[model samples]
Target: IKGKIKHFMWKCYSGILPVSCNLKSKGIQLDEICKTCGEAPETIEHLFFHCSKSMQIWTLAPVTWEGLQEDTQNFRGWWNKLCTMKASRMSDSRIEMTAHILWWIWKDRNWWVFQQLKRSAKEVVLLITLLNFILHLSYLNYSDSIFLSLILRFSLHNTHTHTSRPIVRCRATMDAAKSPPSYSLRSKKEPYLPTLQSDLKSRRASKADPNPLGVKTSGKPTDPSRRLRNRCTVSKKSRRRTWSFGYADPIHLKRLGMWLNLMIRKSYFNILNTNKLKSRKTTWIGIFVKGSRFPVAIPFATSWDNDVVLVKVSPRKHNVLAMFFVEITSAIFVCLFYRQCLPGSLSPKKAAGKIVLCFSGNGSRAGKGAEVKRARGAGLILADSETYGSLFLAEAHLLPATSVTYKDALKIYEYIQSTKNPTARIVPAKTRIPAKPAPFMTAFTSRGPNPIFPYILKPDITAPGLNILAAWSEVSGPTYFVDDHRFVKYNILSGTSMSTPHVAGALALLKAIHPDWSSAALRSALMTTADLIDNEGNPITDAYGKPADPFQYGSGHFNPTKAADPGLIYNASYTDYLLFLCSIGVHNLSFTKCPKNPPHPFNLNYPSLAIPNLNGTVTVVRTVTNVGCRGPGVYIASIQPPPGIFVKIRPSILNFSRAGEKKSFTITIKTEGGFTGTIEKGEYSFGWYKWSGDIHVVQSPMAVSIL
Candidate 1:
């Protein structure tokens, strides 16, 4: 027996099992009546022995005694009698079985009281029997055939009916279940199972015949004996089918469990991959207020490590208070509201040595902080407007400061209104590593389908843009305020300016590794290997928390790790670019003349595909060069077609013999109907095509529009 079970048994013997009577004796206020039967006061003896439910379990159990009724007066007496075998014969297995029965009985009672789940006496007995059998198998070495025969005999005995069929059929079904099915990888047909056919036939026959087994059925079996028999003996065919489904073989079940465990492990690995390239230097702020249990943690982009504790003040809108003397803390300070915290608006006499709260807008975020510093304020809190949503930016401020979302600002406002005297402290910021969902598209990220050249996809890729900590110039104030004099060596900033360096750095690294590859090849490597899923192993979402598409994320968030080994890359030369420009009606170049018949801009061999106008059908060609993989490699094509569009590939497989080998494929896209307006107006339908091999998966985004 497990240590927990032994501990439970010891508690039962000591009369310290927390029964209702014992709880009442301990001064807990409640009726000490039997919770199961509810007919008598609930003592330990009544609960374990005299209760009608417990009595039914004992009767249904295989073990019994003659003087059990007399010993039931007290639990200790009954336990002593059972252990000494004064009322009945006792063996090691029989004693163990009794302990399991008692444990399950207590568990059932608790389940009924707490979860409202009620189990019958016969169900409890069946569970105990299975538990004992498993324990027996673990300790004793038994042959497979012997174990099967024992199980069959127990099942037949419980049914209380005799059948003439040979037991060999059951053994054969169990054997079939143990063996795995055989099928070829290239075969289209699934391997067949004989047991499945038989099971299906049995189900059909049962549905057609009201009494398939020639036994009368009842709507609800009320008699205890009838219910027990009905539960045990539903059908022989069903039992055989259950065994055929791998229940009879523990090894088969173990393999299935292992496969499920592996899938869960893979999912966790995908989530962890989101933080693979996260920066080590980052900073976040925390606001600690009096009377609150936990300090509100605010993730900020840039901040100064200056701590301050002062009385909080929220001045009335546009109200300037005259200087008044009050004895509270080190200084007497006044707070200015959002619009009143601007440059030349704050009265230095009233705002000195205080933290100012300013809402973002009338000025830049950093400008607000700079204005607070000009007034000799100790710190600043820049609250974002609703337009910013959950996105927070890092800005170089002239003073110790942090920015908060509109929602968190509301919480701080409420605290100020409810408190008699509000006091707050700003904890100095420090760097934090591996923030979750790191590469989400910022609310301010530019999205598009290329207004000038509709055939070419815009915003080719994404990278870490929000809250990036980078080196800063110390020549000017952090906020660039003319009067501000503060300087910092490092600062956090956001936007395309920050994201551009990330991609540039990646390109430099790839170029250093493969010095001969062109810029187009480098871009293709990044776009094709980008990740479409976020940290939680789900599709990446936009600022509004909806699943983002190619327009919002381009080819997906940049993944430098996978980009280093992109198996195939799409490359275009200068002439191809000129042709693309000519096809898009940009043929004003003085150095080159336009070709009489220029290739369509969509056929420029770009990493991504975009068809802004698909009147009926369009076929585009693309070429890829195998630059990474060695030896002969074969890749199979898989397509996730855009909604309301049907796409076909000329050749669904690519075979390459060596590095630098090129292969070309054509994609033909058409609407289900002859015309193109099936999807919502002005919305582009999205899809993807992947070329997968044993080692790599090369993917490209596809966008389609009706107008």
Candidate 2:
């Protein structure tokens, strides 16, 4: 009740209501005089207190209000004083009554203005009193429940709907009981009537396959580049931030749910646009929240410049920034971790103020961001994860950091590798043309027939893991040396390690929402719902700008929205992992009991397909579980076999009728007879097998490594 009173008072203070005086002041040119009295303008003061009807109602109020009608030309000032009055501060009833009277007056005035309708002072007072009485009788938390219901009713009654056009807005009641957030979108275009749930299901399935599911009609897809082009306009304008922490922070925010604990501060949007204006002492950026009647701005005291030099780094063991600060020669570039190239190793001379090019998949964002700042480096160019490219960044980050797609990072890295010189520049966001697409693939994401097991695919999907900002541990310096104990709380980084968590987070969300789904089904959902193509509807590519193979992209880039409702899933069990270990000759890795007769590793029920030793032919078995809406998804297998590989799925037709229903099939990969090239010449080839059903196109990648 107190909250309601404050809200009513705030509305008057904000001056947003279409009162006659406010409208006239804004040049609305409507009738400026009060419609009921035609004697004075309908300002908050006149409408709420000075009006003859309001005066009469106040005179009859339960609480004494003899002073209100006197010197009441300014309602705002009078209300402020009244709020601080002892009666108002001490008695909730006083505040509630004031709000009730003000509400009735405004309500009556609106009725007169909109419909020339009148309710006698007596009747209006009765209604206000009745509402207040009911609120008083209700339980403490029950009023908000009533408010929600009332808001829903109000929307239905007042919202205008067009039969021919799509609704521009959608509302879904969120269930508090659900831990993982759910996504719901309703297209505002006309004549398309798919339910939100059905549309989401199909979208999830299409993310994994070329063919769309559940869609009734077929047409060319909208230009892929344009799908997210509007993002530029949607970028926030300010970096001013507040840090309020209570809820546990999530490293992987895969759902669209409101995060109660995190206070996100992003300065890149303004800093990246510094190229537009001449130099200034401070530049201002604004943060505008939807439905907010106010706008906010954050000021930065700097400019954006491309003089920032960039160099590639790859060593998982050392502080990359610190290494570059000391190494004045390019020979240090060959830093490798153990036997593999990591990010900690580097090469360069007097590289102070030069931005370093770092892989997204190599290290912790916190460690990287801290180290770079301390090293006095100009800036950092973080690329996306090796497996998933498309310049992925942490949604909101700290430090002077930016990113490029995996492919773009690859080109830059190659330029340095070949030319031995690193040249880098930052393009102002405002100067970016709408037509050109940034290359976003990374070249070096670890790919596999699972190093130890030829039948299992290692990477499940891709995400934005390049140049992302995350909270840093303040106890360590950017270099993280025992002697460097400079404490800070944020950093930036990229790599497979970063991308992996992204998928894991999305998986966590999927699990929270679909509590009944098995681990295998979830993995299948993530893979099958992944997009095999880039934004252009073409195959996903590698960092070199060439088309990528399954060995590089695994199942394809990750798509969490679609994974939520993947029409069907591939289910795996603990026994499956055990069998995989046994088949790979590493059964000793497990501590628990193992199945006496472990199935073949190829038959362990995984979401992906990998035939490492296709000497002549290999057969892998898998199972699909139904998880979509009503009715069976009658699907037929269609394969896009990797080059030089012939593939066949036995029992190609899978008809699933109910949720939890499982169907099994075998995929046989055979090498082409005439293709006699050495395994070393062309080690692997890629393609996909899709099960096209009426409502779902469940797809899986097929990687064939020539023996």
Candidate 3:
């Protein structure tokens, strides 16, 4: 049996007879035709190495072998030459791999013949090469078993690389994983190649081979482009903006969910008109404001020309000013294009100032996605009522000038504190205490009976919270309104919400200069020098009724121009808040409700509370007289004391007899009421009802004595 097995294997290796083929009797011989080619006579050397057709298949293999030179007609010579290649000897291990592959191919061929089946040349070579590589890898990582490695490699190769496409003819049992083998001249001339070509062509045309795995396609594909074009471009004829402003902030989006679709769609509305006035002369060049004419102005200018549309933004809401600033700053990214591009030419002279739509609402509602979407379409956002007040205070503090009145400073303070975050609660109150100074009471009645102090005297100051116009989403109501009122504009929205941004906008202008001031110092300067007068030219006090108290109006309503020239602003420092916190029994403060270790007061993390300190009311005097050229003057000067402090305005109502070159009045302040700590004395001058612009007003030197 051993002799028979050895002889059979040798015959199989030589490619003449299958390995398992049993020729027990001499009269019987192995079938004579090649299993792969099905044409040539079966011979050991013909099947394994010397077949003229089989040798052609080797050309397609990625590896080259020495067998090409050693033999043209013998299995022994082919195998010996392949094993002796420089590639095989240079790496002893590679030599073994080459031998294993040849052996596997022969074995597979033998198995196919014994089973009475045909195997393509490509399949044969693929199996051999794949198995040898796997076996080599296995030997490197683990103990290699020749039999198991060969089987595993062959299984993987067939599973992964067997394409549905038919293989072309090749020689010497090609690897299945390799590309279809190249056939020799004789095989190429055979009828199979033509048949295969015809079948492949039909398959492709019929879409049976449509869009194969890695093929590139040409022309337009079925899917659409990803970037969406602006839809508002359709109606370019219209040149006006009639926006319906909404006061809904992003945080309350859940409450405004039904309006979302409108909000989203409305963001694409027309913002700027591109068409210029036809009559205006179009210049391609102009002089630079600073010096030489680098580039001239041009009409209907292309992007290359230095041109930009300057927008003046106003805060529509209290919180929204900062939010809008942040949003717009981020959206346009002017900084990115500032230096690289040339500036744009100016707009036509008549169109230089277009009536741009701006928003004025609280940041809370304005910052909402829907509102922000609407805001993005506007030219600028403005700070309404109270926001303007707050900004006035900040301006007074930062910018110093001559006629800074208490009323202006106080109003500014009120605006700032109201806009402050809820956590920064520092509402001033006048608690009943001995040595309380008499508050200068002025009569201003509330519309309704004063409700008992509820929720700790909220909304420290009041501003107009009635009907207002704002952005509105078409989603909430009918798309087209039957009545103008039903349209989205001018809906009433009230709160410190509307008032806060009034001050914020003013602050924005001030910030335009000294942008680095801390929030605490800004607040202090605004509050300290405010006048205690009401709009009626009378001292502001609780006598005005309607839940009125010092706590309700921290300082007063803001006046921007007045704030710009405030005489002596109560410049505050960080130590003030800390001191106030200590006074209020907030010792050992920490960011955490209960921190184990509190940072030092001097630490950057420590909060700034710039409140003023009055050692004690000392004699302070100031004199002011109108030196105007003309006036029918009824001047009013009043003192507004700080919370828990008192003041007495002597002859508070100034009645000027006639328009005079000048008139003098004396004002004094005494710490007469509820103040435990040291009080500061300050005086201010005011000329009211002086209608003539020609009148010149001179204020006396104000002095304060602190004991």
Best by TM-score: 1
Identify the runs in model 3 with alpha carbons over 4 angstroms from their true place: 1-462, 471-490, 528-552, 573-576, 587-707
Which model is ahead, 1 or 2, in terms of lDDT?
1
Model 2 local distance difference test score: 0.47
Question: What C-alpha lDDT, on a 0 to 100 scale, does residue 576 get in candidate 1?
Answer: 58
Runs in model 2 lying further than 4 Å from the true structure:
1-439, 477-488, 587-597, 674-682
Write down the TM-score of every candidate: 0.52, 0.43, 0.22
Q: Order of candidates by TM-score, top first? A: 1, 2, 3
| lDDT ranking, best first | 1, 2, 3
Q: What TM-score quantifies how close candidate 1 is to the native fold?
A: 0.52
Report clashes for each candidate as comma-separated counts. 1, 34, 92
lDDT at 7 for candidate 3?
66
Model 3 is weakest, by summed lDDT over 10 consecutive residues, at: 284-293
Show where candidate 1 strays beyond 4 Å: 1-340, 348-350, 674-678
Best by lDDT: 1
Model 1 lDDT at residue 517:
64
